[model samples]
Target: MYIGLGIVLIVLGAILAFALNIDIPGVGDDTLGYILMAAGVLAIILSFVATRRRPAGYTTTRESQVDPATGSRVDHTDIDPR
Candidate 1:
């Protein structure tokens, strides 16, 4: 999925950016290397944001909560939506 591709691109970019310090040809100079690294990092971050899941009817609470739509209570301690 997108997550996998993001991880791959990030890792590959890091490798390419550093070039293993082996001195490879056609890899460009330090400026281009840094740009590539920045672009890759940005891409990965965007991909993560794009692929994140947001559940519907979701509510944020640290304690017992009331379901907004159902008007029911969700007791965290009881594990029962009563």
Candidate 2:
């Protein structure tokens, strides 16, 4: 989600910085555009880092038992780690 948002921000910023010709009183269009572009790049990089550090969804485990009365084997399976 953040990656998509970052791409949108970068595209908007590029339009504002280079394609537009409007001039405001206190704020510069080019400056704001550059800031937005920088923010977008940062967002993308952070998103990548966060995704890389996350763990997997589930854990698997197996167990075996002996049925004393019938002298038979049994098995068990567990999905979660904890």
Candidate 3:
């Protein structure tokens, strides 16, 4: 989702920067375009960083054990304990 958003932002920024020529009161088209492009780049980078896979040492496992106090079966789940 983030990657897609970044691509869209980049595309929109390119259009605003190069395709159209409009004069606004306080903001210039080029400035807005540059800002959008920068934001898009940041988003793309952040998405990649956030979605990276975990290290090999990380693992998830489930085990069944009997509870000594309760004297009943119980399910235990462990994730990346180390």
Models, CA RMSD each: 9.9, 3.1, 6.8
Question: Over the stretch 50-81, how does candidate 2's per-residue lDDT look in tens digits?
Answer: 98887768788999999999989999999984
Candidate 3 wrong stretches, greater than 4 Å? 53-82
Order the candidates by lDDT, highest first — what do you get? 2, 3, 1
TM-scores for every candidate against the unseen true structure: 0.37, 0.68, 0.65
In model 2, the worst 10-residue window by lDDT is: 51-60
Top TM-score model? 2
* Better-scoring candidate (TM-score), 1 or 3: 3
lDDT of each: 0.62, 0.89, 0.86
Error of 3 at 55 (Å): 6.5
TM-score of model number 1:
0.37
Of the two candidates 1 and 3, the one with more favorable lDDT, higher being better, is 3
**Where is model 3 poorest over a 10-residue stretch in terms of lDDT?**
50-59
Candidate 3 residues 1-82, lDDT tens each? Answer: 5888898889889988999998978999988988888889999999988877434466789999999998999999889843
* Among all candidates shown, the one with the greatest lDDT: 2
The per-residue C-alpha lDDT of model 3 at residue 41 equals: 93
Query: What is the TM-score (0 to 1) of candidate 3?
Result: 0.65
Compute the lDDT of residue 79 as modeled in candidate 2: 94
Compose the digit string of candidate 1's lDDT tens values, residues 1-82.
4556656665666675666554557765554556666666777777767656533354444567889999999876423232
